[model samples]
Target: MKIAFVSYEYPPDNAIGGIATYVQQAAHLLAQRGHTVEVFTASPTRTGCEAFPGLKVHRIQPLNRTSFPQEILATFAQRHHVVNFDVIEGPDCGAEGREIRQQFPDLPFVLKLHTPSYMLAAISHIPMTRLAQARFFLGSLRRGKWPQSSPAYHYRADPEYQHALHADVLSGPSQAILHQVQTDWQLNPANFINVPLPYIPPAISLDIPLDTSTQRVTFIGRLEIRKGILDLMRAIPLVLQQYPAAKFRFVGPAWPSPQANLNMQEYLSQKLRRYAASLEFVGAVPLDRIPEYLAQTDICVFPSIWENFPLVCLESMAAGRGVVGSHAGGMAEMLDGGNAGLLIPPKQPKPLAEALLQLLQDPDRRQQLGGIARERVLTEYSLENIGQRQEASYQAAITRHQLKFTNSPSIHA
Candidate 1:
């Protein structure tokens, strides 16, 4: 099958977060399986097609600095006229594929679910400032809609949500995120499907021997309220009180907190000042350096308020490090209901501290959990296993597209 992926984020260039990682891994895996995979991605500086063995990347530059999506649509249309892709897939985060779907209504367009902007706003507890609330109320009045009636007014306004509503097929990496979007959008159960993301284990061995005596806790992700970074910082003090020798490392770019009027690093510095020597803030390292940090880690903690499927957890598990993940989102499932790693409630510093302390005290338990997590990643989240599932999902989407548009004009024409 000839597959085309449209994503704003793609690795080694416009890589931002999990979406880039997912697209790169999935596209490469599909290509390796004998599928002609073409990726349309953004490039701030360069623009052209880069051909790999089985994959082709079309790096698109924004036209007049105004129409990135329009440029994508035009380029895709020209390519489709020649290559005639079997399926086109893209993330539901920014509706990057929305224009493509509009152009080729009969083509199988899969809206892969990532956390939408509205959901991110909610997760971060973005306060409705007085001016913002006033604008919303005024806008509702102008549109002749009651503000109170539309609790999800933001969802309705979001292009990502609208794209999900009309896509040929919707697929997500986690049941938790799928369920949330299904309920929120009032989507038909048959239209939504769960497909886990693919993660290729690092080439170098992640089997570093666990240092039991000293606890090296590492958190890898943007430091934000949504990621429960504040909760993790609070828990650090508690953990340090019990086990003073334990060291905490935060490896990621720092995000500013609107609620606190300070960046996370600043907040951490001010709050956890007493334990300054114990904490390490390694901000914004390259993708290749992550495995190095993971190798040095003993216990990895991800206490996010909510997440889709986090790649960080998968990396930690793959490195044979015991992970303490929050139960508020897909981490619970990723941890296999606490079998592979420790699970804790989100937004609660007490439980997080307790969980961290539990692993810190018991070296055998950490080793045991890490071994189980490694095995789980090898078996479940592997490239081979996830690639097969992705293929099946794409085939299913094509079938569904054909059935739905049986009487419609052929997109090939």
Candidate 2:
């Protein structure tokens, strides 16, 4: 099958987060499986096509600072005229594929679920801009309700919501996120499917001995409220009180805290000043260096308030590090319901600290969990498994598109 992927983010150029990683790995996997995979992505400085053995990347540059998604639609149309792609997929975050779907209604378009902007804003505690707030206030007065009321009105206006509503099919990495979006958007259950992300395991051997001389607890990802970083900072003092020798490492870029009116790093430093000697803030390392950090870690903790399917957790699990993730989202399923890793409640410092202490004290249990985690990733979330699932989803989308257009009187006319 000839497949086309439309994303604003792709690796080595505009890569930002998990979406880039997912696209890179998935595209390569499909290409390796004899499918003609073409990736339509954005680049700030360069615009051209790069051809690999089985994959082609069409890097698009915006014209006169125009909308990126609109540029993507134009590029996709030019390529489709010649290549005639079998299926085209893109993320729902920016609704990058919405314009393409509108222009090419007969072509199957898969809206891959990433955390949408509205959800991210709420999760990160980001307040609306003054203009938006004023608009909301006026809208509330017209509806005769408080500014805080009418969430549905806000959702309806979101481009991501509208795009999801119109996609040929929707696919997500976790059922947790899929269910939430389906309910919020009032979507058909049959239109959405769950397909876990593909992960390429670290090239290093899994049997490498863990460095257990000093108990090291690592928290990766952006330092913000959504990541439950504040609660982790609160829990650090408790863990230090019991085990003073244990060390903590935060590996990510620092974000400002609106609530504290200061950068998160500064806030955390002032709050946990006494435990400064034990903490290390390794800010924003490149993607290649993560395995080296995980190699030294005895325990990995991700206490996010909500997540779809975090790749960091999977990376930690692949490295044979015992993971402690929050139960508020998909981590519970990723950890096999606490059998492979410990699950704790999100935003609760006490529970997070307790779980850390448990793993710190027990070397045997940590090793056991780590071993199980490695096996789980190898078997369940492998490239072969995920590639097959992705292909199946595309086929389903094509069939759905065909049926919808086939029964339409306008198409017949």
lDDT of candidate 1 over 1-413, digit per residue (tens): 99999988898888899999999999989989899999998888888999998999999877532366677887889899999999999887767887888889878888898887678877877455688789998999999987862355555667777787666668889999889987777677777788899988885535555453446999999998899998898899899999999999999988976445778888788888999999999999998888898887789999999989999999888888989999987999999999999999998999999999999999899999988888898999877788888888888889877876566432210
Clash pairs of candidate 2?
A: none
Maximum-lDDT candidate: 2
lDDT of 2 at 25: 90
lDDT of 2 by residue, 160-220 (tens): 8888766777899998888888777777878888999989886773654644544899999
In model 1, residue pairs whose N, Cα or C atoms come closer than 3 Å (at least 3 residues apart or on different chains), thus clashing, are none
Number of the predicted model whose TM-score against the real structure is largest: 2
